[model samples]
Target: MSTPTSSSSSSIWVLSNIKLQFFARIRRFLQSKATRKRCEPSDRFDTAKNKTEPDNKVENFETVQVTEKHKEKEEEEEEEESVIMMQRTVKMLHFGSWEEKEVAVKEIEKLAKEDVKVRKLITELGVVPVLVSMAVSPVNSRRQAGLTALIHLADGTYTNKALIVEAGILSKLPNTIDLVDESTTSKLAELLLSLSSLANTQFPLASLDFLPLLRNILETGSRSFDTKQCCLGALYNLSTVLENAGPLVSSGVVPFLLEVSSVKEVSEKALATLGNLSVTLMGKKAMENSSMVPERFIEILSWEDKPKCQELSVYILMILAHQSSLQRKKMAEAGIVHVLLEVVLLGSPLAQKRAMKLLQWFKDERQTRVGPHSGPQTPRFAMGSPVNQIEAKEGKKLMKSLVKQSLHRNMEIITQRANAAGESSKLKSLIISTSSKSLPY
Candidate 1:
């Protein structure tokens, strides 16, 4: 009786081991199939077995099998969830269709009110493409939402900037830079600032190429205030990414910036960009490429409508002073002294003081140029050489005319400042001092 029981127990053990091995092999096969299809192993296994295995098979194990209808239902639910999430994300963008400017405005207002939501969505889903689309949309709400989103994005943060780049959002920059709508243009600038705030960390070479598109935007001049401001900020940030961008700075980008610098309200930003650029060799080289930089700068100093432009111009010139004494003389020759006087005349005593100090620098020994020879009589190239003499006279006359125009403009500015004396008395006094010093007694 003992022998018969032992033999029976051994047979049972063998059968159990074989069953376990067969199931293990089946599990491995199912796992492989699931991996190939990118499906869940447990789910796919149950799915495959239910379709192939018969319900009437011998009751050998307790494995659960899922139905095909149940699997389809789960997939549909997942897809529906994804769609809802996308819709919510798009809503955060706030840009309405082209015919709906008012709706766009309202959406943007709502988005601004939902700053925390905007931040979260952007950081989580990288809604850069959505924001860019709003910028491209003709509706005011779209533009406003894009701008506000950017403002929220650029509050000196790192992760927000990373989201912008990761979304390949900069690729859309060329289109935004080319946009002509005022609201769209302004939002584009904000986008630039947001991208720039990313700095060396997130924005690398792949992202840095967008700088040239910005150069194009500034060159185009259809840009609004916000647009130009944002371009300036991006450019300032780009200056920090110098090595990979040597050609961009050298390729007339600086001249475009100098042109923008002549604008009154945005000139300070442009000057700041230039100042940032000067730190890089490529940027200094770019300045050399701008045939009219020194001259353009001088012209900025002379713009009567904007005293701040003049002040900023002077500050930038002063910074460039450390570059080379030759640079100072070159700027002086380009009419910087006269421009400073013009600024002083339009400003208060404090402005005047700043202008006078700059003017004094122009009069510095290093900045002063000695003619080939000096005498009360016009220096002749050589005796009986009328050709050189005539040319020399013409050149001198031109210089004198420029200086005279500058001096005359400065005097006029001083007169205006004196008349206003409205927060500009200091500027008025400085103008008077500079005009007096510039004119021959």
Candidate 2:
């Protein structure tokens, strides 16, 4: 008997796309029939009728051949599907031209814009170090695209916050803040904005040593006005995260802002940011010590077009309102009332509300100075409305209550107003006391 050939053996058994088994098996069967004197398949099967008659519309021979071809085609299709599935299972890396990169960026943006996908992609891509490297690349376009992608990744998700912070993204902030060169605007500004959005995150902003770096940017005279504006925006956002960011802000930011305001060439954003940060830090104790409020802030009160600057003046007055009646008397003596009244009258609803609040805080500042009502050396009260007496009796307590509400309603607004108005380290007390619950007769 003849042996089965490898090719026929492969074709005979559908050995998972391995060909040749079927032909081998057929050859073995034929040899066995010949050796044993068995009838041939053609003779046993009536070969002429089987080969020539039609099974359906076609001849039997053609039908059988077509059926076998169809089975092979199906098997090939399944193999192709398996290969495609394997390709999808692997992590994909894309590289291409600027246009292609932009298309990829747009696709990522589309995914991220969906909100749900942003939260998802951050978790999946969190461990990929290329994302971080791209964010810090020397190439501005690549760097911006990376940062924009990262901001979406971290938006409002605490899980993502932990991941990116652990990935050393926070460590890159100092370098971002230090980029004062004009050519880096697209990259640095994008990075700075991303860092700013992290303000509400749990990522320990103070630990990054960002304050000193930001202070360097704000205080350095060699940088341009645009750089200063960017630094101030970052600083303003950062102040929300940092509890006692007053001294750094106070030591020189106020003076720098005043200088910027005086310059015809200074960017308006720089001055506006300066004003915003001044108001944010106003009520903190450290800021009070910085003594940032003396004269220049008083000067901005008169600039009619700069409503933001005027708002800053009002905020400073509100913080300094914490000083004793003698201090208010001193401020009034220093000509603060004129500019403050201007702020009180201008602006939209939020501005008007802020102005009224500051007005209330300023009017009630009498409690800061109290001698026994009958003492011979007692400071004479400033002549004003009955509100002054009510304020002296209940102002600090009421101011403290208002502070609690402000903290609850929006700590950011109060903080920003304080910083922009130039209140350095002074923060209004956040603690609430039950003592004010029942008015004492």
Candidate 3:
């Protein structure tokens, strides 16, 4: 080792030479292997493997195309079957026996539910008039079939629904809601619910025709709970149109709805319908005339679980009480102030808001009726009408007597219904303390 650097450089060059020789031998071996055309089993297998590898992507794409075509053909066949079925159904519905018509409509009902496009197609085939004709049939089975199919077809499109109505399907409804079975009543109610949407459309439907049927269902007890709800839904839909309110009130729909409003299961829809009705003059008068007006409504405000019902009850009360001294007097006489006090403390935010608003109304109403200095006043301001304290001490005693009697009666009403909101003591204290300024709101 003459020098350490020289020895290391020579060793590195020898290692590089060994690596190059190793790669050159591997290259020579691969070239020889490819050049040999020997018909060995391994050579045949390798060639076959190379040929198969490129087709995988093409095969996957071809498979997708085949699947798409198969789906299209299946759809075409289903459409063809539906067309043939509809054609046969039309023929049977028109010319066949009632039995045949029943079977045919059942098929129509099935097909209509499957596809709305098919529903439109079926109606265009004049099946609507035929179904409408079937709906008028006296045969119960035949009638239900037609109505069931019409309900589905009405669901098809807006035009189809209008056609169903224009064909006078409503007039064909049983004059009374009672049918041979609950099923018929249920289906008919459902059909009415579906058709009631037409009340607001530009299309002129006989809105009055919907009233008697809905009212009968609501009035009847044999009808199932669900069926009555359907009629209420239909009635509610009809009430949305301003013009329908007059017929609704005249049809005596208010009292039964007032009855239903007390039922918690169906209370909200019933309340909403009443709310709609209350805005109209006829509707409001009808409600105010009912004995259930503020009393039934006042009880509803105590419902801690049904906040919406509470709110609606309060809203309807507000409508009745607005500038209505008689109605406000009735509410005060019904012990509403106690219920309202409970709501102010325990009701939902929205309910609390409405309750507070109502309280203000009653407060103002009370103040106006009996101003702070107006009741049992000793001094007289000769300008205004004088029922002052000094002018009438006997009147002062009378006022005190009336107030005591009222507090006693209100306490009884509040106490009886006071299981949950039973802290009438708080309400009692407020009422007794505030008697001079305002007895209660």
Which parts of model 3 have CA positions greater than 4 angstroms off? 1-75, 369-441
TM-score to true structure, per model: 0.52, 0.46, 0.71
The sequence of per-residue lDDT tens digits that candidate 1 reaches over residues 1-441 is 999999988865764565455445545654565455445545555656676565554122223233544665576566456445444434433334444533433443454354564454433433455665665456555556665665675455566666666666566555434445566566566667767766666356365656666777777766667767777777777666666446556555677778777777778778777776776767766775567667777777666566666666666666555435667768766757666655554554555666666555444333233333320223325678887766766665655565556776656556665566564554444445442444321
Ranking of all predicted structures according to TM-score, beginning with the best and ending with the worst: 3, 1, 2
Compute the lDDT of residue 140 as modeled in candidate 1: 59
Per-model clash counts, in order, read 10, 46, 3
Shift in Å, residue 106, candidate 2: 8.7
The residue ranges of model 2 lying beyond 4 angstroms of the native Cα positions read 1-119, 137-145, 155-162, 174-183, 201-206, 216-231, 241-292, 306-309, 324-330, 340-441
Candidates' C-alpha lDDT? 0.59, 0.50, 0.74
How far residue 287's Cα lies from its native spot in candidate 2, in Å, is 5.1
Deviation in Å, model 1, residue 161 alpha carbon: 2.6
* Model 2 error, position 351 (Å): 7.3
TM-score of 1: 0.52
Q: Give RMSD (Å) of candidate 3 vs. truth.
A: 24.6
